[model samples]
Structure formats: C-alpha cells, structure tokens
Target: MSNRNIKVVRVTKDDYDQVCAITPPGQIYSGTDYLPDYFHMLLDMSNVEAYAAVVDGKFASFFLSFVVDNGRTVVTRAGRTNKEYAGMGLQDVMRRNTIKDRKYDKMAATSGAHVKAILDQIKSGKREKILMMEFRSYITSGDQLKSILNTIGNTTPSSAKPIDAIELGDILTNQQVSCHLFPESRVIVDWVPYRLIKSNAFLIKTIRTTVIGSNLENGTRILTFGNYFNTTAGLVCNIEVYGCIGETLAEHLYLHLRELISHEISGKVIIRCFYRQETKSNFITKLMNRFGLDITEIWGTGLVCTETTPEIYFR
Candidate 1:
C-alpha cells in the first residue's frame, strides 16, 4: 500500500492473465479482448519491452514499449493503472523506469494527455529528454456524417477532380502509407500491418474506398483503422483515422463511414482523428462540427522537446 513497498519489474508470460484482469474496460478501442492478444504478441517480439508495477506481488500498473526503426526509436504503445491504485503514481514509476532502461534516439507515445506527463517529469529532472516532446490530436464523432457533409458543402476544389478511390485493404497493404502520412521526424509506433488489421481485434467490418484527388496528389492521405464492439448500447464502433487529409477527403470518408454503420446498429459511431499540428486539428474540428459531431476529447497538444546531447535521465 505504501510507495516504498511497491516494485517495478519487467512483465512476463506468467503475468498475462493478471494484467488482463486489471485492464479497465473502454480504455482501448477494442476493449479488453484485445489486451491479452496484443501483449502476447508483444511478448514474442524481441523488439518489444513491457514493464509493470507490482505491490504485494500483484500487478498494479503496466506500460508497453516497442523498439522501432532498427533500434533508432522507441514508442510507448500503452499504459494504464488499476482503478484501485488510481492515485498511487504507478504510471510515473513504470514510465520513468522504462525510459531509464531503454536507450533510443527517438521516443513517442499516443496518450490522451499528449506527452505532458512525460514533459513534467523531464522538466522536474525526474527523467531525461531522450527526444523532443511532440503532441497530436485525437478526435471522436457524435452526429450523423451526412448532416456534417451538407454543412461543410463541397470541399473539393474545382481544379481537383475526384479519382476512383482505392480499397482500404490495398491502402493498408502499402508499406509507404506510414511515411506518407506522418511527419518525417516523428516516430510512429502504431502502424498496424495488413495481416494484423484483419484479425479479430481489428475486425474491420466495412472499409469504404480511400478518396484521392488530383490537386492533393502529394498531399495528405487518410488511413483508417478501427474495431466494433457489442456493448450495452448495441454495436458500437471506434474508427481511428490517421492523416492530414483535407476537408474534401475527410467529408468523403465520413460519408462512407456513415453509410456503413447506418443500419441495424443502435450504438454511436466514434471517429478518432490524430493530427500532428494545430492547423490540422482546427481543420478536423471544423469538419466534425459540420457533421454535428461534438468534440468529445482532444489529446496530444503537438509540442516537441528534445536534448541536443544524449544523456541518461534515470539510473
């Protein structure tokens, strides 16, 4: 119960069920069903590392990281603390320990709080700045997609004509998609391959075409990945779209999403968009408003901090 009594250790196969048991529902898009599978997969990978806080020999909090880009980068995939241990600061313990032990040129994480928690640790001298601090936005939807489209009105410019969109599957298979979507300096850790995308956790029911345009040929491309769940509300959807696709393509994607989930589902459609900059965030916010979707939450402020020289912050 006391901070001194708790221990932070590397997660092992024996800890799998315990971790799953403590993972709160709705913390992730696929919910609890995906937790075990995901951690198991990570456990098998040589590049992956996971840590947990154990109190009285029981798992209290955990964090997951992956060594990406051939040892040049590290990404914090996810972290959560048990509701029972909410105020214990277990997350800080695990995070600090992992960053101290893991050496990499760059680091990244997708968090609702952006990276502010980590920034605070760095500022207070609790942790070292291994990489620059960067924030991104995650947006979810509420209203009907069609109404939003009508409100936005014709997003496509007259000079740029719509081309036959590609299948979502094809886009997922393209390895270049990640590089095309994210900034060159940022290290992206959630680029799910096509094979994994088809799995149950990522059970993509309806993947509408990826709209393309002539004028925005070299511009942003929207890549969507999400899963559906049968909750108390019915078949709820969590669609995560990544990229800086402008208004026209955004409207097109939402139209397809609306059409796919319109029938036989009483649950709400939650569309999450991750933006690397404030301009893009504003752009997506406007689109969401037009569609009648309220801005449920915004995470990652798109700020980056870095250390000019490499040094260990934790020992």
Candidate 2:
C-alpha cells in the first residue's frame, strides 16, 4: 500500500461511459458488452453505496459497498483500469479496511461493487443482529465437477431433497426471517423465478465462447423473462430441466446452468444454503455435487462464513 493519493467518490450515470472505457475486458460480464440496466439498478439502488477511486487525477478503481438489513456488509467490483494500478493490492485493503469506516462487521460482498454499496448501509450498528455474511459464486458450464465432488465426498444425506422451486421465493415472505436476515438476500428471490428462469437463453447464446463441448444439443430462445414489480426478473437458461427428474435430473440441471452462468456471467458458481432442517439438497448444490459439478460452497446448516472458507472464498 503506497501513499498514493487515492480518493473515493460516488459514481453517477454520467461516469458510466468512463467506467466502461477503463474497466478491463475480463471484468465485464458477458452478454452485456457493457454494463446495462443491471448496472443502472446497482448504481441507483437505495441501499447501496457506490464510490469511484481517483489516483493521480484519473480513475484508479471503484468500490461498491452494500449493507444488508441485519448489519451484514458486502463489496463488489473493486476495479482498476491502469495496468500499474491493477496490481496495487487493493483487494485486501478494500476488504479489511475499505468499509471498516462503515458501521457494519461481518460483511458479505459480491462481484458487483455498485450492488455492494446498496447493501453496505444496512450493516450499520442499528442492524447489529447480523451474525454472518453470505456470498455466492455462480457455477459455470465448464467447471470441473469430478474434482469438486471428490473433495466434499458425499457428505450430503441421501434423503435430502432439492429445495422446492416454490420454496426459493417463499423465503422472502417469512417475516421472522426477514427481521433477522438482511434484505440483500432478497435479490436472489427478486431475480430467480420460473418465468425469468425461462428467458436466460439469450444470455446463454451471448456467452457461447465459454460453453464449448458442453454437450449442448440445442439452443432455445426466451420469449420473455417475467417481471417483478414491473421489472424483468427470471428466465430460462440454455438448459431445460424437462423430462428429467430426481437426483440425476438435479445434477444435470445445475451443471448445465452452471456452465451457462459461469461462462456467461461472473465467476464459478457455488451455493450457500441456510436452512432450518439443514440438509445439503439445494438445487444448485445437489445438482453440482451429484455429478461432481464444480467447486461448491454448500451449507446444509449453521452460520454462512463457517462454510465459505476452504469451500470457495476466492482469496
């Protein structure tokens, strides 16, 4: 950490062009040649705190902090366009100290910074009930499934069942859970739905470069992704779960979706499930691990952090 004069400023729609021009190609999500509506959503989110770092009168990097409802913290998209700054070791600084000034502890950051800022405020002392932070790594189509299963090694119980798709959304309506957990988790429920689940085919097509040899037999187009609160949410991925059932069905479904997502969206896919009964049959977990899908962080029970480590915490 050099004594470089680095300043952090909130980002606006106007800065979007500069951010896009500078952000490395690797940092950009596929299908979106540039940050689109989702970028706007993250930047304008009411709960997030967005900041751009300026070093030597130029954009060096940016950090997006998000506060969960119960004092959980998250950061996303700490990026630097300057090759000299790319290796400046900002991640550790940002992770351990960036949001320390923000009142929250036990932060849970994600891949999108702008999204993180919205989530950071909720982690304030007022929401100290938050004990753990949760993060997800979307599994992609090309992930090494055999290597992953070999590690976790059938820790899952046979009787465990995939979370009922309906249950995915129902988690939101629970007032008691909502009171204890940060509203940030709501994003999953907000975006994932049967209708929205049906339209992701376009995204899959957009990221074809990463899906070579995926056993993809056909390509399907999404007619429409259903809307929530009048905004698009879920849609179908390139893979369809039709004619498949039970564990094998779950495994293939997850593998296929993981390939499409990981290749197309962000990083590898891993699931963190927090449940009362606590069994490891989540749709993504079981599906991935069943076929040795890929690196996964499955939490059948207990706190979120305990499971993230050694499972899939990037660093």
Which predicted model would earn the best lDDT? 1
Full-model lDDT for every candidate: 0.50, 0.36
Off by more than 4 A, model 2: 1-3, 26-37, 75-81, 91-100, 110-170, 173-315
- Tell me the tens digit of each residue's lDDT in model 2 across 161-253: 332224323323444433232233222221221112222222222212111121112222011111111012112132222211234344333
TM-score against native, each model: 0.53, 0.39
For all predictions, the C-alpha RMSD in Å is: 8.1, 13.9
Task: Please count the clashing residue pairs in each candidate, in the order shown.
Answer: 9, 44
| 254: Cα error in model 1, Å | 4.0
Local error of candidate 2 at residue 55 (angstroms):
1.3
Q: In candidate 2, how many Å is residue 157 off?
A: 30
Q: Runs in model 1 with CA error above 4 Å?
A: 1-17, 20-23, 26-46, 83-103, 110-116, 122-184, 187-245, 255-266, 278-283, 289-292, 298-310
